[model samples]
Target chain A: MFQSTGEIIDGVAKITLKGELDAAASGQFKDTIEKMAEQNPKKVVMFMEELDFMASSGLRVLIFAKQKMGAGVDIHLIGCQEPVLNSLEMSGFHHSVYLQETYSEV
Target chain B: MEALQLPATLDALGPIRDYVSEASKKAGLERKAAYNLKLAIDEIATNVILHGYEEAGLSGEIKISFEMNDEKIVLVLEDRGKPYDSRRHEDPSEADLELPLEERAIGGLGIFLALKGVDGFDYQSENGNNRNVFSMNRPN
Candidate 1:
């Protein structure tokens, strides 16, 4: 099962992701991204420490977020597990977003 | 050797991944190899469900089996959905991987990662069934 929660605080969108992000979960992830995009946050921070697995479909949603949020908004992925990191690196998506072990305001 | 059969649907992906994880453990694969195997199987299984079954307007079961030996562990997935040759698709070039977000396309990344994540990958079609074989060598 996949669960996600998001809230915008001080122009930063904080989202926490848990469980497997497979094809079925990508739609929900996209919905969360869409909602965050509507708020026009200057930065988007995703907490993925609890996220166990991610498939290609999940990567697509990350791509969607980058395009929807535009170049000015920085997306930060925090505490991603090794497997998840591997997925991002293999797809060359690591370069598109900021990966952090902990979230800190820039 | 062990096997499992599940309906070709998105909901089954979690269980399918669990099965691969268990098989990886049984084969005594290291962390990196185990994760790679899991990702490889997940990608092909997703394709079988989404493209081969859902897109083709067909419903079927995907049969997954694995065999372990001294040299390697081999996982095979068989589906009766649309026949597809994953090898037909090309891996993204270095330039493609380096493309900026605006220029990037999501298409074919799954298959590319699937093929690249494993030590060996093979695809075959026989009697209307598409078989995907993924293997990882055992550490000496």
Candidate 2:
């Protein structure tokens, strides 16, 4: 399942995703993103500290959000697990988004 | 032409993975490549479990056969429950990843993932059964 929580703080939107990002959990991620987009936040920080696994479907949704939300918004992926990060790199998604090693400084 | 027979069940995922991983390793597949093979097979098994035997209610079995010849690994996954063709792979829009979570479609990613993870993926539906053959060469 996808556990997504979003909040707007200091004009920035922070969305945290945990658990497996599989077919079953993509819907929750999509809904949370739509709600966050409605606020028009300047930047989006996705804290992926607890994310264990991610399928291509989940990654595709991120690509979709980047386009729909426009280029004005920057999405930062922080603390993604190794498997998920490797997947992103293999798919050439690491270039399109910003990845931070740790969320503590974000 | 002895055939390797296995029960078609999610329990088969482990043994199936083990058999593949060992064969790939013996063929000098790199650590990364072996991992990819495992990951790819896991995704296939997951699909079979979720979609193939959805009606089995957690009681279905999947038969997997491993055939290694000439530096290549051919994994034949036979499922009697449903007809799934793995060769009909369509690359989902790379643009969809950016959609807000609720707007994305979940139907195609696993197959894509498995396809990307494996080397040669083929499928044949016959005798009211679905058979998929995933082949990968030994990494140099």
Candidate 3:
């Protein structure tokens, strides 16, 4: 399952993901991003503290998100677990997105 | 694991992964190499459990073996599911992702990732048997 809870705090569109991101979850993920893409947020902050795992399909979805949203939308991955981080790094996604230790309320 | 008739499906994949991870570590393989082994094993196992049986009642044999030499890890994965090479399919193109969500493929990405992640991946179908050889080398 993939979910994105967005709430703008301090002008950043903070999206929190809480679920296993796998092949089964890609559809929901893509739809979530498509909805958010219309908002035209300057920065997209992802809270992954609760995200337990990530698969290649999930990573691909994020790659799609980046491409769909364009360069104006800054994407920040906050509090990513090791498995999620490892997958992104192995897939060369780390270079395409931003990763941070925490959100600090946006 | 042998009694399950096919590649047994477990609630969790930690042990199968741990077993392979430990073996690769003992051989002085890199961490990335170990992880790739685990991923490849999972892809094969998932395919077996999801498609191996005949009408969900019958079962078959799925054999797996491993070896490492000179900074490379080798794995032999075999499943008696309907004779089909899991590696024969092409990965979905970037264009495919542009289509409607409902038309998207499922489970194809894992097989695609496994093929691309491993260093020396090869396959050959023989006499009702499907086999895959996956290998990875230590990172620089």
Whole-model Cα lDDT of every candidate shown, in order: 0.89, 0.72, 0.64
Candidate 2 vs candidate 3: the lDDT winner is 2
Instruction: Tell me, by lDDT, which candidate is best.
Output: 1
Full-model lDDT, candidate 1: 0.89
CAPRI-style grade of the A/B interface in model 1: medium
Ordered from best to worst TM-score, the candidate numbers read: 1, 2, 3
| Per-residue lDDT of candidate 2, residues A1-106 (tens digit) | 4598899898788999987665556778988889988988888899999986676657767867786677778889998877678877766566668888876544
Tell me the TM-score that candidate 2 gets on chain A alone.
0.93
lDDT string for model 2 (B38-96, tens) is 66776777677777776555444577677777778777877776776765767666675
Clashing pairs in 1: none
- TM-score, every prediction: 0.96, 0.63, 0.59
**How large an RMSD does model 1 have?**
1.2
The CA-based lDDT of model 3 is what? Answer: 0.64
Give the top-scoring candidate (DockQ).
1
Rank all candidate structures by their DockQ, best first, as comma-separated numbers: 1, 2, 3
Q: Using DockQ as the measure, name the better of candidate 1 and candidate 3.
A: 1
Clashes of 2: 24
